[model samples]
Every structure is written in C-alpha cells, then in structure tokens.
Target: MSFCSFFGGEVYKDHFKPGVYVCSKCDHQLFTSRSKYEHSSPWPAFTETIREDSVSKHQERPGAFKVQCGKCGNGLGHEFVNDGPARGSSRF
Candidate 1:
C-alpha cells in the first residue's frame, strides 16, 4: 500500500463522496470522507483520521513519521506534521 501510494496509485485519489476508507487486509476503518481533501499529490489525502487511535504513528527519523493501520498494522502511508490545513495538524 505504501509503495502504491508513493508511486501515484489510482485507488482513492478521486473518491470524494461521503464514505469510510478501510484497511485492505483488516477492514478496519482508517479514514473518513469528511476529512478527505483534494491535493496536488496523486494519492488520496486526508486532513485527519476516523479516530484518534485509528492509525498508529512511528517515528522513522527526525521530523518524519510512518503511519500504519492501528488494528492490523498495515503500512498505510506517512504522516506530515504541521503541513496540513489546520495548525499543528497532520496530513495522512
């Protein structure tokens, strides 16, 4: 999933309807449509997750974090801090 997202995969890049995005391997709710937004990147970008614990974050390095499914630990993508619409918010 991370590879596909990094390589500009076309899974949910254009999906803007009100719905929930789940993990392919576990069906755990990860993101919601309300948080979805259009971005210049080819992957689907969200301003937030479905819940505070919906995704887990791991510090890959200084100022970099990797995001994964909280329920199944599937590699979803990366999270960028202070780079989203809201102040101090994260982009997933």
Candidate 2:
C-alpha cells in the first residue's frame, strides 16, 4: 500500500502531533513527528529518523524521501526545517 491510503492529506506539510512516519515503502518504523513549531516542507520531512538502515533516500529530479519498511517501501515525505533551536521534529 501507499502512504496516501494511510495518511493521505492534500497538504501533509501542515503541523501534526509528535511521532514517527513509518515507511510505506519499506515498513521501517522509528521516532519522528511534526512538532508544533516545525517547518512545513512540501515533501515528507522527518526531523529525526532511524540512525541505522531503517531509512534510505531516493533519487529524483529534485529528490524524494522514502522510509524503510519491513513490509514494503513507504514514502515518508521529505526533510524540512527541524526545531533544533526549539524542540521536537516535524514530518511533512
């Protein structure tokens, strides 16, 4: 399945609760989320992700972010601005 089926939102760039964005492409799960003051990047952006082989970046005209899922390949948006100056991370 694709992310659009699970978390399909016209504009996922919107701020959301804190959590991790599982890879609909790889079923890779980890810690991440959209903080209250996170950057709203158009692509799926996770302030934090699995430090190991859990996530992997793909190739594109610009580029697309994909999560490593155990089941299948999942698209977890792209990496945007993290509240490093603040706290928590945002997934868009």
Please give the distance, in angstroms, between residue 73's alpha carbon in candidate 1 and its true position after superposition: 0.8
What are the clashing pairs of model 1? none
What lDDT tens digits, residue by residue, belong to model 1 across residues 8-32? 4577888777888888778888888
Of candidate 2, the 10-residue stretch with the lowest lDDT total is 1-10
Top lDDT model: 1
Model 1 root mean square deviation, Cα atoms: 3.0
Q: Lowest-lDDT window of 10 residues in candidate 1?
A: 1-10
TM-scores of all predicted structures: 0.84, 0.41
User: What TM-score should be assigned to candidate 2?
Assistant: 0.41
lDDT of 2 by residue, 1-92 (tens): 12322444544345365555555555456445532233443443344544555555554333334444434545444443343334444343
